[model samples]
Target: MSSGMAGANTEQPAGTRRNRTSEAGPAARRASRATDTNTEERVAVWDAVAAYVQEHLLVQKGVWIPTFGSFDTISKDIRTADGTVTLRWPVFQLARNLRAMHHLGSDKDSLPAHREVETLKYSEVAAAASVTWQRGKTCIQSTVSLLSNCLKNGENVAFVLKDIGVLLFEGMSFGIKYYYDFLEKLSGKEKFRKVVFKAPWLLDTLVSRVAPVASLTHSGHLVVFPM
Candidate 1:
């Protein structure tokens, strides 16, 4: 009778182990299914949003989607010896998504958060400027002044363009949007007749400290010479 009781006790443990295994199998399968469903839903959402952006916002001017990226429509003015032509174009932005997903994942947080992202293709901005803001009298004056100064004084003007923003020449860079506008204005009217960007760094350093020159001395307007 004692030998029989010992055998029964050992058999009970085996029976219990089988029961536990059977119970866990269904639970594990359920958990896996939940994870898969969640993944599918997230993928669908992303796909829909991407499609919407491509369909609607792709043609608008300066239209940017928050946290995802931006879309821009840019116009340009062409100049030939005979006449001028204006052209408009569009481009998409996706840098913010790439930066957020890949760069900012670790503890060493270097990239800005998604909310801080302000997306614009540097080319679009430059093209817009060439179409619009470059036409301003002040902008034209500044450009002419700087270019003239560089040419006259034999100063080396460096254009440091890193493919992200406007054509930044030398130490300072101007936005492409404004540059485009300036170009358009030049195409429409004769530039450098009134003002020119002859010496930007020098003018900035001196004008900031010295009294304002009423006009470029060569123009013969009442002016204060930088003595």
Candidate 2:
């Protein structure tokens, strides 16, 4: 009797260990399943937005996404010496209410005051200007190439401007959406308009004029535009 009691004290019953494992297994599986479900839901939402934009673009010129902005397309015709070439591209405009969100100040006075602008000779000024122009051109070309690659590969891309906001592109038929902090701040005060207008590669032009390029990265097929 004493020996039997000692054995029972030293070892847990097989049923007891199995019951503990079974108890923890369900909880762990439940947590994992919850995480997977959340991820699936997010993907579903993204897919729904992509589907809506594709369908809208097919029937009309563009579509407006609430809490985001308007998306549209523009057509351009080039008259060359050989023949006329036509091209179509997409454009995004911040919602009218969100336009005031970004304050685009003049860069004319951005140069340092200590820089001798008036005392420079004409040749020196011209050379400096030429160098600046070449640098700008190279930057523009690189940015254009990044965007073109994204379109060609049908990969998702995102751009987060410093003063502006976030721009998201889902490359399945070229859908875009914009988000900003102001949208949330004024959420209760304003509503998104339903009107859609055919709005272009105009972004490339804008990027050239607006912010300086900061960083760029590509993961798998998706590209994150320069900040």
Clashes in each model (backbone N, CA, C under 3 Å)?
A: 25, 2
The residue-by-residue lDDT of candidate 2 on 1-227, one tens digit each, is 00111221222221111112222223232333333223223223333343444444334346554333454444444344545444333345433332333321221112222322111122332233343333333332333344444444444444443222335444232223222222222221122111011112222222221222121112222234431
Candidate 1, residue 199: how far the Cα is off, in Å: 35
State how far residue 201 of model 1 sits from its true place (Å): 35
Can you tell me which runs of candidate 1 are displaced by over 4 Å?
Answer: 1-43, 58-63, 77-85, 95-227
Show the colliding residue pairs in model 2: 90-200, 91-200
After best superposition, candidate 2 residue 5: deviation in angstroms? 73
Whole-model lDDT values for every prediction: 0.27, 0.32
Error of 1 at 225 (Å): 61
The alpha-carbon lDDT assigned to residue 43 of candidate 2 equals: 28
Q: 219, model 2: CA deviation in Å?
A: 15
State every prediction's TM-score relative to the real structure: 0.22, 0.31
